[model samples]
Target: MTGAAERMRDRQMTDGMALNPAGPDLAEAMPPGVLREIEPRHLEEPRGRYHGHAGLLAAPHNVEEVAAVVRACAAARIGIVPLGGGTGLVGGQIMQDGPLPLLLSLERMHAVRDVYPQENVMIAEAGVTLQSARDAAKDSDRLFPLSLASQGSAQIGGVLSTNAGGVNALRYGTARALCLGIEAVLPDGSIMHDLKRLRKDNTGYDLRDLLIGAEGSLGIITAASLRLVPPPAANGVALIVVPDPAAALDLLSLAGRQLGDCVTAFELISGQGPRFQMEKMPDLRQPFDSAPDWMVLIEIGLPRGLEPDTALEALFEAAAEAGLALDGLIAQSGQQAADFWRLREEIPEANRLIGAISSHDISLPLSEVPGFIEDAGAMLADMGNMRINCFGHLGDGNLHYNVFPAKGRDRAEYDDIRKRIQASVHEMVVARGGSFSAEHGVGRLKVADLERWGDPARLQAMRAIKAALDPLGIMNPGAVLA
Candidate 1:
């Protein structure tokens, strides 16, 4: 389709559907407190990537209220953009160039509806923060294993919508596997009340899975029945120095064999990340006196009988004997473990402060990760003198490979080659049997990448599904499918 035609179609989908927050249409349709003017926080995404345009903001308190607002929007054929915690990195919460959409924020629906401790399940509303869900699980002596750096602000609805994968994904899996069922409002204003806390349900066409990672293009999730698990009685963390990515991978294999499933997290970090952290966020203490060229942060959670510290020590000894690790430090206390994690979690903030010219969240097969890293570095080195910070949940083969300016240089000077850098990295990733987009969903930022890298048949099927479910294209227009 031509660019003009696509723009016209997008605008026409919501033609004559202008929403005025003070107008009678929404004022009369929604309850008094549910409708309000768009606030500054609602207009901005976490990364400062995209500025959203919204004519109205709705904070529905219940599923019925959410359905009512959706019903009104469907009748008017106005687009709906769902907002949650406003912490997404890929601009999923922001609608930049579409007709002013109705921003649906589920902040008022923050509640832990029911907790079935016996079944290890909890039903939580969409607005419940990830940290809040974790706390609720702790109250029942269980664990909500979907942990993220933005857990304090990111809502459960947005987490599931993006199928977020975090550090614990190596052990418990992503958000999709943690969810039992979801309650959502379809594009046509119909509520899909399938929030059952069952282990298995073979009903036709698993709509629950469909909406989980749809990024609100298909529907707005109101609540979910989340799977919970037993909390490990003991946990340990260690930071180990490795010669390079290849050695790090070897260390991972040895540790996995020694610790088995108890290995919860295996993160790969570059010297640049620690240097940036020291420069930008000095409050968080660095584990090493000076940043090693490469390091891996390993975490393991174990039952009471299998002491975590002992297990971690055994793994470290084996890794060192195998020439995989040069040096290591095992956490002796809970505070020490938290300190190690702080260093890993704060790297993104440091990256933000340094200002990346281009950031790539890509994944490769476990065996191919080492070669890809080496080849990608060579590729970027040939392009420019840009510094690279490669780090992420190495256990799952996902890396947050980010590019920045050299020391004492500004990113604005490299703006002309940002797209080239991104394209080069993504191309290398694809050529090496890797995904261009991994845990982070393809929000507005990577839609073009999706089109370029996605399979032709898969893209066609996705477009067909979007058309069938939201014929009017009133749900997150100009997102994911272009």
Candidate 2:
């Protein structure tokens, strides 16, 4: 079945049709103000990894308009790569080496269709940015907890499509858990309007889940009914110096025992990230005079009367007594809290400036994380004198373990060993029963890794499902699957 599906997709690709920028096919089919000239930004993705091939850009103002564009692409046998905010780290939003696809941008469709404060739900168009959704939820006295560094630019549809996991995932869960139902345009341009606010609906096959993290291989999500929660009465942030990753794990256990689910985010940071920031972006405020060997950014949101500062202080004291934490500073004001978060958020930008030889977003079982880190570091050290920046949501077992060159050296110097380093790190992760790709979906960049490490039975099932849903393979072709 999979072989036949692949042949069918290949046959469709051979159908003589070219995506012309000024062609009448798109101009005649799209609604006024929807079709626009493709810009350089539309063809580029974050990380400067992939430069997509998009001849024309279309910003649909409504779901019907999106359907019309999809229908036109289907009829023309052209590929459709859905674009949203252009902030995805993965190459999912970009078609780097394929036929010039119809870049379907959802920017114009940004809208909060409805907000039900009582039901703790908000129906938002896919074009709505994550920050916009969070702001709207706050205005309605609710919380949309899918928080990420790229929240300002990442749209809801893209977030749902990748099933993004951020710091708050330790408490609130990822995009999949936050979404109730979604309205989408299928590969055949048919509308799947299943946007319900219900908490429980065991009706039939979960098409919503299927489309959420499929990277648009199955369909293009138009809008979603997002799950919201009551805003925490009191929240505080603290930066604590930890001895090492093992100590960080110990502190995490202590915090969970003390605060339980009130612990919103527990991030592990290495001295390398801070040092890089200080070198590249000294203008940003640093929480400490010097970068410590390791630190943990702990955030807690407590109910009314359970003072967050007091709870954090107690946790700190307990952690210190347990030898898990050395020293810590808790934010006294909102500005201070924001300052602490700013430092954490700016590390990625700093990494970009330094230029990494190889970067990995991996997750390990809670118990295996410390061991994997130690073993991986030793393995890399054996290969070369490389600097490693290991950091991420420790509470969730996800780490952005990146490798770079030694002092005064460029990453290009280590070009020969980039693939070896990535493979070594990923092999350690998988051997320890972890995942090579955690929060980031298997976009075009990681399709090879997925094929290499993905379970055979699971991969087979995914291909079959893709064939069943997107037989022509027009929806984000060559994304999750090769």
TM-score of 2: 0.96
Residue 367 in candidate 2, Cα distance off native in Å: 0.8
Worst window of 10 by summed lDDT in candidate 2 = 1-10
Candidates in order: C-alpha RMSD to true structure: 2.3, 2.9
Clashing pairs in 1: none
Q: TM-score each candidate.
A: 0.96, 0.96
lDDT (0 to 1) per candidate: 0.88, 0.89
Q: lDDT by residue for model 1 over 185-302, one digit each (tens)? A: 9998899999998887897899999999899999999999999999999888999999999999998888778888988999999999999998988877888889999999999888
Q: Which stretches of candidate 2 lie over 4 Å from their true place?
A: 1-24
Backbone clashes, each candidate: 0, 0
Off by over 4 Å in 1: 1-24
Global CA lDDT of candidate 1, please?
0.88
Evaluate model 2: give its lDDT.
Answer: 0.89
